[model samples]
Target: MPTPKAPVRGRFAPTPSGRLHLGNASTALLAWLQIRSAGGTMLLRMEDLDRARCKPAYSASLIEDMHWLGLDWDEGPDVGGEYGPYVQSERGAFYREAILRLQRDGWLYSCYCSRAELLLMANAPHGLEQEGNPRRCGCLYLSPEEQETRAEEKTPSLHFAMPDREIFFADGVAGARSFPSAGDFAVQRADGIIGYQLAVVVDDIAMGVTDVFRGWDLLDSTPRQLALFDALGAEPPRYAHGPLWLGEDGKRLSKRHGSVALSELREQGVASERIVGLIAWATGLIPEPEPCKPQDLIGQWTPGRIAQEAIVLPGNWMDRLR
Candidate 1:
């Protein structure tokens, strides 16, 4: 972690592919609170990289939901700051430049594997960094003749060459962590879209983000992002992955959890304060599930206070708000 005096720039980036569910809103509240309590700059970014699935309507609705929950940001798509184009789809030029620089440094290579071939290659043995660690894809490293033939056939995905070394970083919430080096990963897909791994790192670096607070589900992805940050020669933000809100059945809380979406809650005339208050209580931010706003919890925000274990909420957890 940087010195306490260092400027803290944090962001809440949400993909505009779906409605903001309780899980999403709760995470956002935690992220907003973490940054706000530190008196840091908080940014909202629309991670609409997959343009085909992400819609402007969803983005607008998400902003509305956040506003309803009393969350505010200093920089975002609505309120432009130094980082003008906060939406991922508009940041292709930056990603392309990074790709060029990586290619020049021989840190990127072409991947021509088709969908079926890629699926079969999933089980292919990887160069292990340690026993029982997660493994990513190995480099294709095709010869000149094979490359020429593939170029004529289709556009190849540009993949970052993973350096065979362990990546270790301290998480503000999860504590000391380490991930074994695995296989190469794509920076750009064959369909001509900027890959998630590359875009996330590039966006955070460009926005001068100093802290990253997200859900526990994305904890494993930190190393891959850290690797990209290193390859791109940028200082990575400190990451903190908060516990997830899972269903009572021990599965991730998702669309299957009926009427838990912020939009649905609003449609049912549920007060935003009620939702925020219940989340604050469930996540161990408050002793009681009393009505409150995002700002109300900022004063009591603490890394230790956020629930550590996956919070298993029952199917009718939304009833409390009603």
Candidate 2:
């Protein structure tokens, strides 16, 4: 008999900026299925660093949606595991320590450029406008005196000085991936909140996440994240970015695009199994759409079996539910 492999540690980190939408639900379902199918541990982490937008109600709703869909997590904010405080807002001390380490190791630099300034500079002729260019602002190579002067005028965000080289990694779904460059990205914002790139890398490391399943919209961010994992001396997790869910008009799914939020669907008497079934069919895990729970599709789930291209919903998809 062959020796069994150790169970993979996977996570589904969602931001509580809004109610769970169809896109969010599909991603959550896929992540849950991947972890559960492999007999791996699944964790839920709330990416609620943006306190100004995140709310307890939103988090509650998200948890409710997951439960309704039968996506049970082994560790999460509701259930304290070895890794307690699964919420990002509660993990500030960890982020602070990591930031200090990066600074001590000379991986972090002070960035004084505002969003507007960076946008204008990026659009300027002969400016550092190319994709993944670190010299996005004059402050990238500023002297101590110059940094001090800028600091006096505006609070500086911390940026990771990205190495100018090709980064390579293989995705479970997207296959071999390579990025020619990784632009210097922010680690901490001027408003004092840690940036998503840094926070996610730190959280994944601390939580022992071995695999990550997310939408392909975040594929380009892999290289920068890999650099952070390297600088922090933590092994990066394997990534599988699936196709995004698009509206019938072939545009990204959003409220404006008629994408139904889970809450609204629940109010409309839509069963959770119906939602999961629709997602499963859309992702190529099922021959056709039929009311089914997430568990029912696990036996049929294979990461590579998922479509690499975006799945466009029917114009009257919501009408069918009604």
Candidate 3:
């Protein structure tokens, strides 16, 4: 694979709702290379905003797992760098500001719909999938006075009043991406908390993120986030959706089956370098990286070489001792 040019920042943002799995570790390694090879900063973000689900144990285990996988970061929650509040929960005010900006710009609105209503909307003949409509809420067109009255009455949530605009962004790996937008998306949930889409866009813009490297599963999400960026009148960043790690069952790895956690491999006595090597291999960073230590891997890093498809690890991959 071709090496990435110098000085281009990228990051690994992981949610602490669970352990750092083999899939998570692998992606981190690839993102590390994507940033490090270019002499750019690799930021580690703990996406622990979901207070009900995110546990401190999971966060600690995730950090330990990343270390075990030989992945390091130049900036992160633990180290406390220039981009402090590396955890999403700490950045609520920032998200509020972005949402408020959209609100003032007539690009967002308050939605008082209940979940049952949303589900019914989804089940409506015009609704598609469990996702319902891209433009779901019926209350998005409320007048300012009506919206203010609802706000006074403690309405449910705020939603981005998606504009009728074509969305497109150049994926560093996927080349050009284009999506026809039907409508706006949610910003804050009915529970008065920010959603992933809103917070991520706000965070990226606030953190001065120029580039994003994540899994292909989120490829569709980029367009929505880009639209949110447009609603806020801000330029969006470049994106790269790297390979995913699938199970031997040919499905993307998940907790439903065992072997999901990186710590599990450590318990099985697999060397961290071997794991890193497999990630590098799976992601097409190298056809094979000999001496797979994280330091060695980083030294030989190149973002342009990373693969664009989901990489399925061999069944016996975890069994082999390094």
Question: How does each model score on TM-score?
Answer: 0.92, 0.93, 0.86
lDDT order of candidates, best first?
2, 1, 3
lDDT, candidate 3, 1-84, per-residue tens: 122232466778998988888778877876777677677877788887799999888988888888877778877888877766
Compute the lDDT for candidate 3. Answer: 0.75
Cand. 2 Cα-lDDT: 0.87
* Per-residue lDDT over 192-272 for candidate 1, one digit per residue giving the tens place of the 0 to 100 score: 899999999988988889999999999988988998999889889999998898887888767776777888888899999
Q: After superposition, which runs of candidate 1 have C-alpha atoms over 4 Å from their true positions?
A: 1-6, 124-140
Error of 2 at 11 (Å): 1.0
Write down the RMSD of candidate 1 (Cα, Å): 3.3
Candidate 2's displacement at residue 85, Å, is 0.8
lDDT of each: 0.85, 0.87, 0.75
In candidate 2, which residue pairs get closer than 3 Å at backbone N, Cα or C atoms, i.e. clash? Answer: none
Q: Single out the weakest 10-residue window by summed lDDT for candidate 2.
A: 1-10
Q: How far is candidate 2 from the true structure (C-alpha RMSD, Å)?
A: 3.8
Better of 1 and 3 by lDDT: 1
After aligning candidate 3 to the native by TM-score, how far in Å is the CA of 108 from where it should be?
0.8
* The candidate that achieves the highest TM-score relative to the unseen native structure: 2
lDDT of 2 by residue, 233-303 (tens): 98899999988988888898888766479988888889888898888988888888888988898899888
Q: Which parts of model 3 have CA positions greater than 4 angstroms off? A: 1-7, 119-134, 143-154, 289-291, 299-304, 320-322
How many clashing residue pairs appear in each of the predictions shown?
A: 0, 0, 2
Candidate 3: residue 315 Cα off by (Å): 3.6
